[model samples]
Target: MGFVPSQDADKIADTVEPLAERLSEVLGVDIQAQVLVDYTGLVEG
Candidate 1:
């Protein structure tokens, strides 16, 4: 998947909601994310 824009004219929650579950399976971890949030210095475990 790709980055989803922070704001959209249509409600986007439904569009991005499934990514977390799919990514979690692919990444072998509990994956969670949001658009355009400041993740300045976060690191992955």
Candidate 2:
């Protein structure tokens, strides 16, 4: 997932990672999440 303003990336990851872990536990599957901040905005561009 992408966050506007970039700085929120860490905060977003902090929140998401735990949820991903919980989902993995409940589903008995490996759920992974990597929150990357695109400073260059190349993805959007």
Candidate 3:
């Protein structure tokens, strides 16, 4: 997930983590919520 540069990192985590948890349950696998630093970071990931 990508957030605006000014958005708080914790806010991003709050929004994404829950979804990740739900997905992990449904998929029966670990799902990490990775917040991208930038487009380059996403590409590298």
Q: Put down candidate 2 lDDT per residue, 1-45, tens digits, no spaces.
A: 333445676787888888889989999999876665475663654
Distance from true location, Cα of 22 in model 2, Å = 0.4
- Candidate 1 residue pairs that clash: none
Alpha-carbon runs more than 4 Å astray in model 2: 1-7, 38-45
- The models' CA-based lDDT, in order, is 0.55, 0.69, 0.75
Give model 1 RMSD, 1 decimal: 5.2
Q: Residue 5, candidate 2: how far off, in angstroms?
A: 7.9
Q: What is the TM-score of each candidate against the true structure?
A: 0.44, 0.61, 0.73
lDDT of 1 by residue, 2-41 (tens): 3345577134545666887898999899866544322342
Ordered list by TM-score, greatest first: 3, 2, 1
Count of steric clashes across candidates, in order = 0, 0, 0
Question: Given candidate 3, what's the lDDT at residue 36?
Answer: 73
Ranking by lDDT: 3, 2, 1
